[model samples]
Target: MNLKDLLEEEKRVVINPLQDENPPLLVVITEGSTTLARALIYRILIDETFGPNQSIHFILYDSLNFLAFLESTAIEITACAPNLLEGISYSADSSIAFKDADVVFSIGRARGYEFTKNERRESFFEEYIHVAKIHGEAIERFSKKDVKIITLGYTAARIILQFAKSIPPENITALSLLTLKITAALIAAKANRHPSEVINLITWGVNGENSLPDYRYAKFRDGKFVEEEIKNDVWLKKNLIKGVRSASGRSWYSRSSAYALADHCKLLWNDTPKGEWTCMAIYSDNSYGVPTGIFFSFPVYCQNRKYKIVQGLDVSENLKKYMKETARIINEESSIALNAHR
Candidate 1:
C-alpha cells in the first residue's frame, strides 16, 4: 500500500524455487529520469512471470527529480497493478538504492528539445557517467559481488565502460537488443512475415550509429532458410543500419526499446532458446578482432544469468573492417568519457 511497506518487504527472505535454500529478496535498482524509468518499471511489472534468482524488489532511484518521479511512478503502478505495490519502493539515496542490489539498470537522463548534438553528448557524459560511476562504486562496495548491471538508453553502451574499475566487465552489459529486434523486423517486412518469425539476427559494433547488423546467420524461425527476398544482401547493405539508426531516434523509441530490454533481461534471467542466441553490448576481449577493453555489441548466448559471447562464426573481410571501425569509434568515445570524468 505504501513505499514504506515495500521497503519493509525488501528485507524478507524468500525460498528460491530452483534452490532449496532461502535467499534475500531480488533487489533491482533502476536509475534514470521519468520516462525511461516509468516504461521500464511498468514493463517489468506486467512481465512478472520472469526475472532473477529470487522474488523481484524494485528500487526506483531518481536523484534530480525524485519528487516528481516518485509521485508519477506511484500513480502509474497503482493504476497498472495496485496489488504489486508491496514489491516496489522509491529511493533518492544511492546507498539505499544500491545496497544489496542484485541487478542494476542505468538508463536515461533529462534532455531538452533544443539541445544540439554536441550539447546532448556533453550533458550525457556529465550526467549519465557520473550516475553510472556512483552506481558502480556503490554496487562494488555494497551489493552482491556478482551483480549484473544492465544499461539502456541513447548511449547506454558507452556509459557502462566508465565502470571498468568498479565492476567486472562480465558483470556489466549494455542492452542493444533493440537494434537486433529492429533488424529482425526489417528483414521480416521484406518477406511480409512478422518480426518474431525471424531468428538469429545479430548486431556487431556499438549501440548507436556505428552499430552493424549481421544477417549472415539469421534465418526464419520455422527452420527454413531465409528467402533471398528477406535476406536481400544488397537491400540490407544499403538500408538496414540507416533504418535502425533512424528508428532509434524517433520519439516513441523508448517504449519499444524498453519492452525489448525487459524481454532480453528475462532471457538473461532464465535462458535463451535451446539453440538460439541474442545480441548485447558487453566488454570486448578482442572477439572477432575487436580490441580489448571496450564495450561492443555482439551475439551472446545467455543461460542461468550468465552469458558467453558467441565465437568463431566467419566474418567477411568487409564486415571485419566495419567491425574494427565500430570498435575504434566506441574506444574513442570511452576515452572521451574517461577524460570528462577526470
Candidate 2:
C-alpha cells in the first residue's frame, strides 16, 4: 500500500470510533503565526472528548502575503516561544480544510502588522480596523454561510472562567462567571468578606476592547448555568498581577483566543441539544435597532452545530450609549481602512 493509504489505515485503527465519526472541522485564520491555532487544536483533541473518544479536524490558513511580516512573526515565535503547539494535524488543501468548517477565528490583519499598544488611540483604532478588514476578507475567501467568525477573545467569557478557576473548588457548590468589569454584587459563601459586599470580581489591568466585550456571567443556581447580573469595576487588580507573574511573556490575545476557540469547539462538537449560550462577536445590521453593517458583540448560543445571536435582552440607555460608541469606533475604523487603501 502507498504511504497515504497506510496513514489512513493507521488512523482508522488508532483513533476512537466516536471521535472518528464525522468529527467537527475547525479553521483558524491568522496573519502569520499559527501558534495559538495549533494550541487550540491540541486542547480540543485532549479536553473536548468525554472519555477516550476524542478527535477533531483542524486547519490553519496562515493569511500572510508579505514575506517580511510572515518571516518576522515566524522567527519571533520560534525564537521566543518553542512548541507553543506540539501535536495537531491540519489539512493543507483549502477546499478540504474548509469543507465543513464549524468555526472560523480571525485574529488580526492577514498580511500581518506588528501590534504594540499604540500611544495614540487613533493608532489603536487603525489596528482594530485592520483586524475587521482581515475578518471580512477571510469570509469572502472561505465564504461559508454557517461558519461563525470571532475576534480573538472578546467573543468568549474567558475572564469569567479564569475567575471561576481562581475560586476554591470546595467553595464552588454552585456556578460563577464574571463580566469584563466584574463587581462583587453577589458575595461568595466562602469569601472572607460578607457575601453582600461588592468585590472586584475581575479587574482588567490590560488595555484594548477586552476591557469592554458585551459578555455575561453564569452562576450555578438551579442545577444549570443560569445567566445572572453583570456588573463592572476594579476588584481583582492584585489577582491579575499575580496571574501575570505566574506566567508571563505570552500575549494575552493568543492565550484568550485559544481558550475562546476551545470553548467554541466544545460546544460545537461534544455538547448536545440543550443549546447553552455564550457571548459572541457578531456583525450587527440594526438587528435590534443597533447599527447596520458593523461588527458587534452579543450573547449567542450554539445548537445543532450552528450558532445564532440570542435576542430580546433588556437594553438600558447606558448600554445603548456603549453600543453606539462601539459602532462608531468600528465605522470610523472601516473608513480608516478604506482611506489607507485609496
Candidate 3:
C-alpha cells in the first residue's frame, strides 16, 4: 500500500469505534453563565430523564481551557457523580473521553438584546454568522473524531426576536409567529422581550417530521390565537434578514432558562419526547429545499441511538417563500463565517 494510504488506514481505528470500546458522553459548552459543576449536574439529570445510562463516562470540554482543563474538571465531575449516579461515570482521561461517546453538546453564547431591543438591530447579523461558522467547523471535528453519535444543543433566539420586533405587528402572520415560537426561549429571557402579552406563540412537529415539516404555529394576537397564512412578500423580505441570529454582545437572556433549554435539548437528543417537541434551532442542508447547506430552526428527532431530520411533509407556498428567504440569509452568512478568517 502507498504510504499515504497506510497512514489513512491507521486513522480508521479512531473513527466510530464499537460502542463497548467508546466513551459515552462529551458536552461542549462555553461559560458565559454555564460552569463545569453546573454542566455536569445537567448531564446527570438529563441522563436520568433520557437514559444516558448510569454506566457511561461523560467528558466535559471546557472551551475556556480546552482539553487542558480536563484533569481538574474531571475531579469535580467525579465528586458530584457517585452520590448522583444511577450508574454513570465521569472522566478526564483523553483516551476514554471520546470512546463510545454518542452525544456532543455544542453550545456557545449570543449577542443579547439588552444592549438595544427596538431599533434595527442589524449589527448582530454578522456576529451570528460568525457563530454559524464556528459550528460548521465543529461538525467537521465531530465527524472526523466521531466523539458524538447523537449531537445536541439549541440555537440563540435573540436575532429572531430583534427582527420580529422590527416589523408591524399587523403585517406579522402565523408564519412569523411560528418562527418566533421556535426561537421564543431565547427571546423570553431577553430584556424588553417576553412572549408578547398580546401574542403568545405555539408550535408542534408532525410526528417528529421537521424537514418538509408537518408543523403549525399560532399567535395569541388580536385577543386570541389562530393560524393563518401570510401572503406579503415585500413585508416578509423586509423584516426577515437571512442567516441573522446568534450573538454574544451583552447579557439579557435568562441564565436559568438557557441552562434549562440546553439540558432539555440533551434529553430530546436522546429521543425523550416532550409535549409538542423540544425546540431547537440549528443549521440545515437540503431538507426543506432551502438550498444544500445553511442552518435554520426546525423540530428534529433522534431514535435508536441516531438522529434523522423529521422529513417528507408539505410546506405552504407562503411558508416556503419565507423558508427560502431564511435560506438566502444562511447562504450569505455561510460565506461570511467560512471566509472571515481569510
Local distance difference test values of all predictions, in order: 0.66, 0.38, 0.36
Q: Rank the candidates by TM-score, best first.
A: 1, 2, 3
When 1 and 3 are scored with TM-score, the better candidate is: 1
lDDT of 1: 0.66
User: What TM-score does each of the candidates earn?
Assistant: 0.83, 0.53, 0.48
Candidate 3 local lDDT, 1-342, one digit each (tens):
554443222111112222343333444333212463345355445445334342333444323234334444544554554422323232222223333334434333332222222222464644554443343343333323433322111122222212223322111111111233333433333322344422323222110112222214423334332223334443223322221132221134334334444454444446634223333344444677755433355544545533345566557787777677655644554444345444
lDDT by residue (1-342, candidate 2, tens digit) is: 554442232111111123244353444444434566545545554564322433333344443233234344433433423222221233223343344454555554311111233421466545655455444443445545545444443211121112223322111110011232122222232233332233212211122422332223333333321123222233233343333333322344454446545654455445333534544344453755656544444555556544465667666686567667655654554444456533
lDDT of 3: 0.36
| Models, CA RMSD each | 5.0, 11.8, 12.7
Best by lDDT: 1
Where does candidate 1 stray beyond 4 Å? 1-24, 49-54, 82-86, 110-121, 153-166, 227-231
Q: Write the per-residue lDDT of candidate 1 for residues 164-274, one digit (tens) a residue.
A: 356677777777788788888887887888988888888777554555778777888777766454546667777877887666545456677678767878878788898
Candidate 2 stretches with Cα past 4 Å from truth are: 1-19, 23-34, 49-54, 63-103, 109-148, 153-218, 222-253, 268-276
Off by over 4 Å in 3: 1-33, 36-40, 43-52, 63-101, 109-145, 149-251, 254-269, 272-279, 282-285, 311-314
**Best-performing candidate as measured by TM-score:** 1
